[model samples]
Target chain A: MPTIRVSANGEAALETRDVRVRYGNNEAIKGITMEIPRKRVVALIGPSGCGKSTLLRCFNRMNDLVPSAAVTGEVLFHGENLYADHVDPVEVRRRIGMVFQKPNPFPKSIYDNVAFGPRLYGRPPDLDDIVERSLRQAALWDEVKDRMNDNALGLSGGQQQRLCIARALAVTPEILLMDEPASALDPIASAKIEELIQQLVEHYTIVIVTHNMQQAARVSHYTAYLYIGELIEYDDTNTIFTAPHEKHTEDYVTGRFG
Target chain B: MSPADSARASRHFDQELQELRELLLRMASRAEEQVRNALAAVKQRDAQAAQRSIDRDGEIDALELEIEERTINLLARRQPMAGDLRTLVMTLKISTDIERVGDHAVNIAQCAKRLAEALPVPDVGDLDRMAEVSTGMLRDAIAAFIDRDAELARDVCQRDDQVDRYNDSVFRGMLSEMTRYPGAIVAALQMMLVARNLERIADLATNLGEDVIYIVEARTVKHHAGEVVSDVETEGEFDQ
Candidate 1:
């Protein structure tokens, strides 16, 4: 399969060329080729078991830990293939961070959670400034500044998710991959996370996997619809929501079917 | 089976959508009736019948308001997408077009009342023909909307040129009659106003047809229908 470059300006932050993932005898992701533009949020949406998350994990090489899982094809970050022999998985993960579905903050204090990633790199000279800046970038600074010493688990589900975002930001990753980050929160908290996503695009490229069509429409600049491990359509969010070219995408987004 | 064949999982959402469709059809029916009554009043030269047509426009106005309120409620509550979203947005626009059609009907009825009071009734056969074509377009445009037939909608758009030609001929004939008979100026001018109203009604019907095409095909046919290779040349012909 040929690489599909969706962006016209040749400024893709990440590009996947005919990538597929297989676990033992079962193929979870068929071949998909796409480009994620710099500083723009790209949303991958589909029904459950459509391999959206599996495709996301390929970005940071999180699938390397699975014993039977195998990823094939090229995943390029800044013109360099990530699956090359010499690249370190730990360094790749630090540069391309992830926030999972549920907020899994460590049992340490709020200050410690935000400082965790930076500490892994042997402690920067401006560690306090880095922690405060990451928290502010995640939009959780004012709420957690007074309780920096408090345990992260003591915070609300929404606050804890923001802390996780802050932890990811502390590493100063060039790209952020979020997997259903707001699904576990209430309406107000979900709206706050959405607002944070809109702001974060100014600093980091984002690729999000979401089942909520409305959330995908609201947060992402570009949207790709996946079905049965294949990419059905990918276009600007306004075009996808208003006048998608494919019938399957239209049916899925309109609540007619999955 | 296609995905659209699968019913929306939310039963209440389906109910609300059906209700909106029914109300819009009802309003279309009422507007069509007003045009027929106004044309009938002109044929009979009865001021009382014209007054009746003018008075019924209030009902169309009220229906427009009701449809507006219901559309806003659905948008806020249901948050529809794709086809449902297009349907809701098109409903709001089509209702406005139907309301304006009602207003044009009222204007024609008022012209009928004025012509009834004049000294001599002028020859209005051309005006009658204009009304016939305009009303047929309106009725068929509404039918196209009901059936979601883009072909029928395109046919309706093509018929608009015939109405415009009729309007031009009526204006020229009225001017010639005024020159021949000075005492009949008032009645001739009233007939001219009637011709103009019919022309506007035809334009509104074309608008309705274009909207139906939008809802069905998700492509805009407005302001560029001429480029679509129709039998009629609709470019730079009318201000619309």
Candidate 2:
């Protein structure tokens, strides 16, 4: 119901048309249709179990990992139907990367963790260049550049999250899907990731799900308010925070939610 | 109460907002009473009544400072959004406007005190009408704020020009009175000053109207023509 501009190029990086997901007999995501603008951050926010994460997973087909889940409708990446029969779910994930809430880095060196994704497709001819670029893009290169061989788990929680982001960025994904990416870290660490998301948007379209309304207001260009598995309102960040169209969105963002 | 709000347990933030609303209403009531008493002082040339009006200006000033502190504290503590955010910001603005109106009342009372000592000038008669219009606007703007009625606030905005018209008439009439009766210069000048204060109050009332519209509709109707084309539809059930 909200009309939003996708990007300067006028092409949406991702879109979902009537996409719904049911885990066994329970519906986690109701049918939701929205455009995710290119090279910008769009935050999905709501109270617990409002399907913010479920909708974010829909973008990269992470929902497919659950055997009980059934997805109906299209999740398009750059105008291509990702659910098409001939399409490979594995390749769909490669082009559309994801970062989870916890900083789940592989038990390897920082360089190895970043290189793990690119190494899977058989090492690129310039693997060093790819790892460096991804680490730099994730805003973690400066912090971990000297210790590229240090175990990722040894890094602080925030650095580990950035390392995970670096891992996701290594494969040169067109879009990034993050599920509560900063909720686990301390405020200082969380602030760094939020700042990183702002920088990342210049090169990649980022979809983030955050329970912190202030974080969503800080980092995202647009905000979507989901309630009871329904997209209640989607609008520009200013409108969502200061003058949302739906009272439900107003109540939730204002911390009046039950 | 709307079902959406009633279903949720009340927040301490809600109590703070309620306290803010009550403070704003009390301040507005004091400002309205000041205008009324000041105008009565002019009509009866009652210096005692004018002094009474002047005495209350400090109370309004203190209330404005208190509102500012509470609103700013809530903004930082609660990080309020949507209607709650608008209400806090508007409270800051409307309190300042009311405070200025309080100052204007003191100015009018000062003129009344001066006129009480001067030779009588024939009544310009416009002061009484201007008094009525400006006071009515001040009263209704606060009502619209309390009631969250954009239509009533818009009506108050529309009445502003009427007070300005009366002010012009009072000035022209005073010009002739001073010219016809050279000895009546002091009285006529004080009367004109009273009219100017009333006009100022009306302008402040118009500002209150615009601030009320902002809170109710999330729209700016300040510089626009009387037609306020804003998204005013904020009604319906909120899906839980």
Q: Give per-residue CA lDDT, model 1, range A1-258, as digits (tens).
A: 221226737888999988899999888889888889999999999877889999999999999988899999899998999999999999999999999989999999999999999999989999999999999999999999998999999999999999999999999999999999999999999999999999999999999999888999999999988887888888888878888878888878877663
Q: Which stretches of candidate 1 lie over 4 Å from their true place?
A: A1-5, B1-12, B228-240
Residue-level error in angstroms, candidate 2, position B160: 0.8
Locate the minimum summed-lDDT window of 10 residues in model 1 chain A: A1-10
Compute DockQ for each candidate against the true complex: 0.48, 0.38
For residue A218, what is the lDDT in candidate 1? 96
- Model 2, stretches more than 4 Å misplaced? A1-10, B1-10, B228-240
Per-residue CA lDDT of model 1 for B1-240, tens digit only, reads 233344545555778888888889999999999989987887777899999999999999999999999999999876888777888999999999999999989998998898788855456557778888999999999999989998888888888888888887888788888888888899888888888888888888998999898888988988885743233443222334
Whole-model lDDT values for every prediction: 0.87, 0.86
What pairs collide in candidate 2? none
Clashes of 1: 0
